[model samples]
Target: MSVYYFAGASIVAALCIMIVFKIHVDKLKHSPEQMGAILTKFFIGVAFCEVVPILLLVAGFATMQTGLEFNNLLLPLVCIFFSMIIAAVFIFLQTKVDVTQEMRGKVYTFAMIGLSLAISIPFFSLVGLLIQMQ
Candidate 1:
């Protein structure tokens, strides 16, 4: 149940990032420079809200697994960060095009693809425990 809640919240959080980008893209019509500034703010906001909590969760998981040392946690976290960066570029590129005929459709498609890993990777850790029960 908690995992479901976390997964739902992660999806919502990723949606929020897309929302922020959409809002900035709208602002681009009036002030082009604002897009860059706004995106920088968006990244900072995501770092505080999304990245930090995810890292803390990873740290907590290490504490729970007897053989898992906290010192080794950095590698996975680094991998996730890089993966997010690659995704962020597409998220950023989506903002480049002028507001389109299929804007909502595009937003939904981008959000689903970009956020799948964001939501799935954490929830995936629980899969082993679930599988073991059977």
Candidate 2:
């Protein structure tokens, strides 16, 4: 129950971070090519950050339901495979979107910040789970 709440909060936080990034991106004047690159990098960062954690969290929940009967390595393998597939799709779609310089720096910065928040929340949730198990 609490894990679900934590997951929800993490998702909301990620969305907020993305909105902030969008606002920042809107403030700068970027050429179409620059916008496309920035968006591509941002999407890739986000896709990796979002999918991996959520899949791992789902796998964790599934394992918990099974009462520890599952092989530990299976979760990671599944998560990695699915995350890669999802990321490839995201990159492909983002490349198709018709849409930076100092803008490059801002884009990378926002991407990093967004990725960090997105990745960290789930990581902290993992840590909390570990602590609870101890």
lDDT of 2 by residue, 1-134 (tens): 33443344345445544554454355333453366566666566555546655664554455442222224333433433343343334333332333224345544554455455544644554443443341
Total residue pair clashes for candidate 2? 1
TM-score of every candidate: 0.38, 0.43
Model 1: lDDT equals: 0.47
Error of 2 at 73 (Å): 15
For candidate 1, write residues 9-105 as lDDT tens digits: 3344445555555554465444553545655664565555566446544544443433334344444434444445545665657655665544555
10 residues in a row with least lDDT, candidate 2: 91-100
User: Which ranges of candidate 2 are over 4 A from the true structure?
Assistant: 29-99
Report, for every candidate in turn, its global Cα lDDT versus the true structure: 0.47, 0.45
Query: Which portions of model 1 miss their true places by more than 4 Å?
Result: 51-134
